[model samples]
Structure formats: C-alpha cells, structure tokens
Target: MSLALNIHSQRFQLIATAVAASLVTAGALAAYNSVSKRERRRNLSEEVLRSVSNEASVHTLPDYSVYKEDASNVRYDEELIREQLARNYAFFGEEGMAKIRGGSVVVVGCGGVGSWAAVMLVRSGISKIRLVDFDQVTLSSLNRHASATLNDVGTPKVKCLERNLKQIAKWIDVDCRAEIWRKEEGGDLLEGVDWVIDAIDNISTKVDLLKYCHDHNLKVFSSMGASAKSDPTRIQISDISHTIYDPLARSVRRRLRLLGVTSGIPVVYSTEVPGDVKLLPLPEEEFQKGPVKELGFFDDFRVRILPVIGPLPSIFGLNIATYILCELAGKPILNPLPIKNRKKLYERLLRDLLHRESKLTGETINKLPIDEDDVGMIFEDVYLGRSVIPPHLVPSRPALTRWILTQPLTPENCVVMEYADAEKHVKECSNPTIHPRDIWGEDVNALVERRSEEVARQRAPA
Candidate 1:
C-alpha cells in the first residue's frame, strides 16, 4: 500500500514539474514575440518617418518651373543661397565664389569616387552638374557611396545622385544621363561642360574618355586606381606624364603615348605601391564555362572586382573635388610636390651633371649656373622625362647634361639623356670642333631649340 502511495506521489510530482516547465517556456515565448512585435513596429515607424521627411524636403525645394529650359538661370532667395555657401564664400571671396557658382561640372561613373566629387562640388557652390553613369545601386554600394541608402537599392546611380543633389542645392541643375558614354555619342553627353571628372574603372573606357577629352581640348580631371589603396597621404595631383608607382597610370600613359598624347592631362593618383591585394579570383566553375572576358557585362571591362576599402575612394574623390574647386576659383595647384622624394632625385641629377661637367672641363666646379629646380624643369617640363634622341626612350639612368658644351649650363641649354649616352656624348662631342647636330641630327637640335624658346617665354615676366 505504502509503495503504491509513493509511486502515486512520484507520478504526481513528475506531472507538476512538466506542467511548470511548459508554462515557463510558453511565457518566455510570448514575451519574446511581444518584444519582436515592438521592434518591428518601431522599425516600420522610423522608416515611414524617414520617407515622409524625404518627401517633405523634396516638396520644400524652391520652385524651378519658371527656368525649366535652363535651370542654371533660376534664381533662389539671395540671402538663403549666400548663407548656405557663406563658409565657401569666406574662403574663396566674392569673385572666386562667383566663378565657382558659375562653373559647371560633368561627373562620369557615378560610383564611390564620382558620387562624392559630385556632392562636394554641389555643396561648394557649383551651380550646374551633369551626372552620367549606366549602373544601378547595389546593396554593397551603400558603404562607399556618398548618398545612397537601403531605399536607393535597384535605382539608377545617376538618378540617385540627381535626387540627393537636388535636395542639397535646390537651385543647382543636375542633369542625369542613365546611358553609357560611348566614344561615338560622348560628345553630346559632354557638351558645354566646364570640367569633366573621369572616375571610370574600366581601363579601355577610361583611356578612350581621356583621349577624347585630350583631342577635344576639354578641361578634365581623372582619378586613378583608388581600389586597394588606404594611405591618404600618398594621393597627389599631377600631369599624367609625371604619375609614378601607379599601374593604371602607367598603362594609360603608354596607350596615350602610342596615340601621340604624351602629356597635358592632369590626374589624381596614389604614389603608394600597391600591397598584396589583387583582383578577386573567378570561381573554378567560371573557368569551366568559357573565356572570362566573355562573362563581362561588356568587352574590355574587368570581369573581376577589385577589393576596395570604403574610405580610399572617398578620399580620392575629395582630392579631385579640392583640385577642381581650386582651379575653378582660379587658384590652381601649379606645383604639387611629389611625395616620393623627387626633390632628392633632382638634387642627385644636379650633382651628377656637375661631376660630368668637371670631368669634361678639367675644373673642380662646385656649382653650375642652374640649380636643382632648374634641373627638374629641364628634365620634366622641357624634355618630358625622356631622352632627346632617337626612340626618345624614358632613360633607365636619366642624366641632365649641357646640350651645347660651349654654352653655359642654363635651362635653355640643358637636356635629358641616359647616363651612358651623356658619357658617350662627352667623349665624342666634347671637342670644340663637334656640333650637337652632327651627332644627334638636325631634328633633335630643332626640337631642343623649340623647347628652349618655349621655356624662355614661360620664364619671361608675364
């Protein structure tokens, strides 16, 4: 009987324990669902509020219907516009501000780099901008894009820029072109723009656009290879011929040179040698499928994506914007210092030239008439960093030597040559009887004279 009673007690206790555990789990689940519902409601409420705010902002923009034909002519409240741009006006002053406000810019490739450039340009008082891109905003773009949000996904990038930029400066004209810029139709797209910003990533397209701009005498600024670059200090603005330590610049320079374009294009590039980062590899199955180039959206576009840290492209954009703004304000950066210690190279070249001259003249000369800066001008600006001889190859061991030994060392007489070529010229043409034309041909002499005269005119008082 007692055993039966104990068995009943154990059974009752087990039932109670099971019922208590079930109640706890059910209560916990109910609480969790309550919290989850609250979170969902809160998120939905915030999203709705944000949407309403965006709509309100759009509606509040100054009415531009009167100047529909030319939105740039539409006048806004003078006090509001000035207040919006007061900080910029303070720095650039009235005339500079006027120039900036009147200037128009066209930004191609509205991606991480171009988008930021467009935003800053608008914010800085640029009255007109044209955005050209044939891409859609993806989920991944939000990290680096200047104004894209989750809501902007699947929208055209140029349209996204237009919508946001219009909100930033109600009076500004934002022309959105949602088509690719082909060489055949690019002229129409770029027509009447004060500046063109080339933030294109595709190598062939970039080269084509730059060449087109060069051919048409368009004022253009290009951004080079911001992917996989992190160091902001390494960024620089220089003519394309002088760009160094950048693979994109090197390839573009070579192609442009082949097309008879050696220089005169300004570019923003990173001097930092790329690290171990590489283009993302294609899957093995992709190789099994066929040629990788065939898989690209278009021929010559990169099939593989580059690994980009979000901040690098933004920095590049800022640099481009800063450069363009200064230029539009008529305060161009005439002498951007190359970060790779080019001054040391110039100094060394000067020393080598002095030594070579001492050997030829049989005098221990401590100095020449020209200084290191002159040497740099002669080597870079005058000769375009190549030998003034047949083939005009970029010298492996570049040396600046006197073109005419009889003439004293001066900007007009100095020339760039290979170290060995300089030595050979010293040995063979050092004689008072020999003329440079006899050895280097009359064409070289004429080229040198033309370059010298150009330099002379440049050095003359304005």
Candidate 2:
C-alpha cells in the first residue's frame, strides 16, 4: 500500500511540473508580444510623423503631391501590381516580382538618363525612388531629357521627374531633392537604398559618388558620356577598369585610381568608337560662371555641356533600369561584359590615357621599363588602394614619386629618399624634415595648367 502511494505521488509531481513549465512559457510569450507590439507602434508612429512633417516642409514646392506617402496604413495593391507585372510574372513569378515592388532605388541626377530610369523603375514595379538634381529645365535639355517639357521649363529636374513619374504610376512614391547630390548628403540619400544610379554627367561628382558608394558598400551603376553618339545599339555595360573609347570614362578612371578606387565600377557605355565630332561651343557664361566651378565643387573634374540625342539617353536609362531590376531579382545582368580580358583591354586604355597626358606634358611616363600590360596591372592595383610596390619609382624621380618612391624618412620629411642601396643615405642626410620638392623637382604642372587654360578658352561665338 505504501509502494502504491509512492507511485501516485510521483505521477502527481510530474503533472504539477508540466503545469508550472507551461505557465512560465505562457507568461514569457505574453511579455514578448506586448513589447513587440509597442515597438512596432512606436516605429510606425515615427514614420508617419516624419512623412507628415516632410510634406509640410515642402508644401511650397510645385507638384509636392507626388512625394506624399502616408505610412500609417500600407495598402498593397497586390492584385494590380501582380496583374500589371504579369508578363514579369512569367519571369520572376510571384516572389521575385514582390521583391522588385519592395526594393528602393536612388537616382542621382534627374536628367536624360535618370528621368527615364526613374519612370522605368516605377513602371517595372519598384514602388519607391529618390531623385536628386539641382538644375532647372532649360531649352537645351528638351532634346534628350525624358521628363523635360515646355511646361517644365525653369523647374527643378527632380521635381519634373517626380511629377512625370506620378503620371505613369499614381501609387508609387517619388522623393525629390531639388539639389545637386554632393558627398556630404550621401548618407541620407543612400540610406535604405538597394541601388544607386549614377546618372550625373559631371565627372568629378560622379567619381566622388562612386568612391562614396564604394566605401559605404552601396551598389552603384554609372552612365558614361552619351554625347555625340547616335546609335542606341552601341549601349553596353563595361566595368570602369575595362572602359575604353569614352574620354570621360578614362579621365574619371584615372582620377578614381588616384583616389584609391581600383575596382570595376560598372558603367553603361558604348563601344562604338567616337569619330572626330566637333563639340558644340558653349556660351561664355557657361565657362566663366559655371555653377559647379563657381561653387568650388570637385577639385579633379568639371561640368561640361554635351550634345545628346533623344534615343541614346532613353536607351541608356532603360538599360540602367533593367540592370537594377535584374540585380534586385538575383538574376545575372544582361549584356554585362566580364573582366576576363582586362589585361588586354587595360593596356589599350593605358596607352590611350598616356598619349592623352603626353599631349599636355610633352612626355610619357618613362620611369618603368616594365611591359605595358604589367604597368596596367600595377596601376590597377594601385588605384584599388592595394599596397603593391610601384616598380616604376627610382631614386632619380622628383616629388619622391609622390610617396611611391620612399618610406618618407624621418617624421619631419626632410629626407623622403629610401636607402638607395646597402643603406648609406640615412646616415648622410642631416635635416630629415626638409621639403621633399627641394630634393626632387618636377615641371608637370605647366602642362596641367595648359590643359585648364585650353578648357577655359571656350571659343563659342556668343
């Protein structure tokens, strides 16, 4: 009878333990749910309040209605979006199409390429886009710009693009920053963006943006110079390290390399070699009073006016939109050229770039006796911020090869020369903090100034 009682008591304890475990679990789960709900409420309230506040701030801007997004309630028109993207449904199916709708994109420069890209992204099911451009619509932009019209004359490009985008898809949200995209604003503009489209024509700003994106781990695609090209079929995407034919791309590449960006910046470019097309002259005001230069913008590149056709920018914009969608959908980019032949292509590019520089300096980069292809690789590595020793630097070079020459002897920099051989110079030099230029001399700046003066002499018959 005592043994029977022991068994019954054990069963009772087991049941009580299970009951206690269940009660504790229930209490913890309830607490978690309550906390989660409260946090969600706070986040939603902040979003709605921020949206409302922005609306109020920009109420005076024209076509302000297009930027409105009431985050209080997210009413997904799933049926409409899916039906509209049914053809895409054949591609991404339901899940992929949904990703496109949910993704966000930022297009800097709402001009010919960006305007078209913005509209295409919206139509392709991307519900949100941010447009940046400071320029107001002028008559000159009407030829190629997708969003510009006589009605949009004197209006900011972002505003015009936003307005036009809304006409295409009323449910989409367009954020307009009627200001030029500068490096300082990168954080806010790129925040939460899946892709950044570098439609900016200004080389300096474009390169700066590329560097910014590169550092911040943001994905960006640059549109190369579309000027004077008439063939839409020539539009192709080439990595920056492999770019050729486009002078703008090469210049930007060289500058980018100096700034420690050696990786391939994918650009929408054309392989159709440019002919000797005489550039159209710009007004004196364009050169003397250019907005970019006047504002003391980028140190390396300047803005320029270029001729563009209606078809080319449109095609370029279409290509950018396509790439962004494909990238977001986890698919391979269509027509993207690989860097497999980078050695061959880079040599040709380097030859061209060197020759271009020679026109100003009257001499080639003669330090390295290495093979041309090897030189190309060295530059490629150098630009990527890699620490590979530049074999071109010698003791004779002035400017210490700009740090490529020596270990920068002494903290004062009087002696930047590396130990020439078995290490005797270290004991010989007295003042280590002497100016490096005094030890090494150069006259290359004359050529640089010559190039600048030539550009400033805009021979336009105003």
Model 1 lDDT per residue over 1-462, tens place: 354435358788898889999999999999999999999999999988887888664457665464343335555677878988999999999999999999999999999999999999999999999999999999889879999999999999999999888778878888899988889889998999999999887667788899999999999999888876788888888888777656567567766877888888888898675555545556677567444442111222243356678898898898889999999999888898765667678888988988988987899998788765466557765676799887899999999888888878788888889889888877778888999998889999899899788557534421
Following a full C-alpha superposition, what root-mean-square deviation does model 2 have from the true structure? 22.4
TM-score for each of the candidates: 0.58, 0.58
lDDT (10s digit) by residue, model 2, range 1-462: 454435358787898889999999999999999999999999999988897789665456444342255432434366655656778878877777778888999999888888888888988889889888888888888987887889989988888888778766656888889877788866887788899999987766888899999988899999987766787676788778776545456567766887999765788887554443554455565655544331111222234454467789888899889888988877757567543654664455345434433443457664323233233322332222122123334333111112212432111111112224102222222245643233332332232233234323311111
Per-model RMSD to reference: 15.9, 22.4
List where candidate 1 sits over 4 angstroms from the true fold: 1-75, 283-304, 340-462
Q: Candidate 2, overall lDDT?
A: 0.63
Global CA lDDT of candidate 1, please? 0.82
